[model samples]
Target: MPRLWTTRLLTALLLALLLLTAACEAEPEPRRYDFAIQLNGGPTGWPVWVEELTFDHTWWSPGGNLGGGFDKRPPSGGATAVLSRPMPAPSSVQARWFSYRTQTFYEIDLELPNTDALLQQWYRDYPPPDYRHYLMAGFSGEGEVYVWWRARCTVCGRDRSRDFHAPIVESAWAEEAEGDPGRYRNRTQEYVNEGVIPSPW
Candidate 1:
């Protein structure tokens, strides 16, 4: 009787160990998301920089309302990424924007000395339909070293900033253009002036 009991106990222990191993193997670990931005192709000597890049103040997941409606808040903010300082030598600069919410990326800014070709390339990447507004900084003006981005909304006067993606730039000192190099600010301004937005800049 004692021998029989010992055999049964061993069998039960083995079964329990097998069950525990199975449970541990069944589930895998989840992946964490790291939001970031990268820059490539800027003026030869200019250093990369990012400023005023604001993300949505609030957080919302699958079923949340992520508020700040069309009347009060828009969906996003803006940032300026450029080379650290302007370089005298001829060079090209490229800036990229990252969207953590959608897991998307786009080449938003690019500048080549004495050529509009880089600007044209930017258009191909950020087509009119994909994003509502666009802004860039790659020119010198007024001695402020200013670089601005398009505000989130041109219509409904709301900033979608409550739960939106902010840009992360790789370079710095990518100055603003004298005229509308990309025409993003001008277009957004038009929308705002027409009461599309509560405030126009």
Candidate 2:
């Protein structure tokens, strides 16, 4: 009887340990959000024809790219697109433009927004005349949030080519929240405007 009881107790402990291990190994549900991107034609319009648009993020899943056979936008005009996916915000977006005029393809990097209060506010009131006319937005990361933007050029050359930074913004990681935390998680519907690609003449 003593031996039987010991065996039963050991079996019970083993079952409990197995349950605990399974619980620890369980993966959490993925957090989802909407990522919006906008592209403008700049003051002088798009210099090259767009061949493809690609999106890449730091997350583990596969990002996507799109084929573009679209016409060039007129001066001061632009386009907008969005992607809704799980956490791990996009690291960079690129636009591959084919310049029939120049017979070359130019890859333009789109700017991302920083996840900060002041920058978020600035994004809402974007295209501010006094500043450099930058657009900003936010996104969630593994343990942080980020704000990104594309800076506009104050001046352009006669050929419409201007020296400019690809994109720039600030980021703040979450201190309180655990797992994949996004400051904008409460916001189910928000569009991030990935700014314009200038004509590479």
Candidate 3:
């Protein structure tokens, strides 16, 4: 009888440990927010192929980007990706893309406008429970990156934002373009400006 009791106690202890581990593992991670950026191919770099892109932000996922949306593909002269990240809003970012026209990979630093204040404004007016915030950053073929702040209600399609014509601010290239020595710079700004975003803004 004593031996049976000893065995049962050992079994119970093992079962308790297993339950504790399972509970710890079952705990869900914090909810993540959504954000996106659009990388447009400048005049000289027609149809940029984004190999990888990332923003300097909190731990949301591995490899900087979610590895979907526009990465590893050509944006046909203009494209961007919607990324998920913990944020106020990322102001600094990096892009490594291959220019098919240039036939070389170029890494450029992208500077986005800071919109934390706008985000705060929207959050105060549009509570998160009923609304979600979205950021739209556009890289102009004219060599300017424009940013916009928008909020939309989850329940309804209703949304509010400052349109492309009036972007919060345009981000400039913190780094100079040097790699591949392609049309990205050889072309005229006026000509580049003539190119429009293939994807709907």
Candidate 4:
């Protein structure tokens, strides 16, 4: 038992060191958001837990139905999740997906393909079996709000596969709101004011 305890402690220490390294070596700046809420499957019964990660991004609002934006659906039928970010550059955008249930993170790369052509290809290639829908509250450096999807390729396994990319369509930022009493309400209003609904991939 003592030996087992020592092994566990060593493993924990190693993991902590890795996370610390990632945090320390980050580039640009970090993005702040409310929570990556899971509206379906295992998260159905549990109250949502919000986690904050450091990244570069802009703040955007939620317009379309969360599930309609991409291919993956929450294990549950109806999923409504809201997250926030400070702002990011406009040159190009990409994202990383983390499966909390599995404790794994996957990187997704996006290429600005023709919107119509990309959508048609997405329908034929990145079918329901391959990709999933994700919502991000992004902030553009110029105070624009953008929302998009992290499409997962079905052909490749999560680790080996290429992240789904979509053409840029809709992007905007939330407008300034007068003083609001409730924090959640204020945040929701912020999302509504600057929120964007990207075309479903």
lDDT of 1 by residue, 1-201 (tens): 999999999999999999999999886543221122111211222112222222122221111111111111111222223333322222333333221112222332333333234333433444333333332232111111222223223243454442222222223443332332233445334434665333323
Question: Model 3 scores what on Cα lDDT?
Answer: 0.46
Candidate 4, superposed: residue stretches over 4 Å from native: 1-117, 133-143, 167-171, 181-201
Query: Which residue window of length 10 is worst by lDDT in model 3?
Result: 61-70
TM-scores for the candidates: 0.21, 0.34, 0.43, 0.29
| Count of backbone collisions within predicted model 4 | 20
Go through the candidates in order and give each one's C-alpha lDDT. 0.30, 0.36, 0.46, 0.36
- Please write out the lDDT profile of model 2 over residues 61-141, one tens digit for every residue: 222221121222211213444344323334555444332222333443545543344444443444333224322222222
In terms of TM-score, how similar is model 4 to the real structure?
Answer: 0.29
Per-candidate alpha-carbon RMSD to the true structure: 19.8, 17.1, 10.4, 19.7
User: Which candidate achieves the best lDDT against the true structure?
Assistant: 3
Best-first order by TM-score: 3, 2, 4, 1
lDDT of 4 by residue, 74-154 (tens): 122234444543222233344432222222223323333234344445546655555553433332212232344445555
Q: How close is candidate 1 to the true structure, as a TM-score?
A: 0.21
Residue pairs with colliding backbones in model 3 are: 38-80, 44-183, 44-184, 45-184
Q: Which pairs clash inside model 2?
A: 112-148, 112-149, 113-147, 113-148, 114-146, 114-147, 114-148, 115-146, 115-147
Q: Which stretches of candidate 3 lie over 4 Å from their true place?
A: 1-45, 57-85, 102-106, 111-113, 139-144, 153-166, 171-201
- Model 1 residue runs over 4 Å out of place are 34-59, 62-194, 197-201
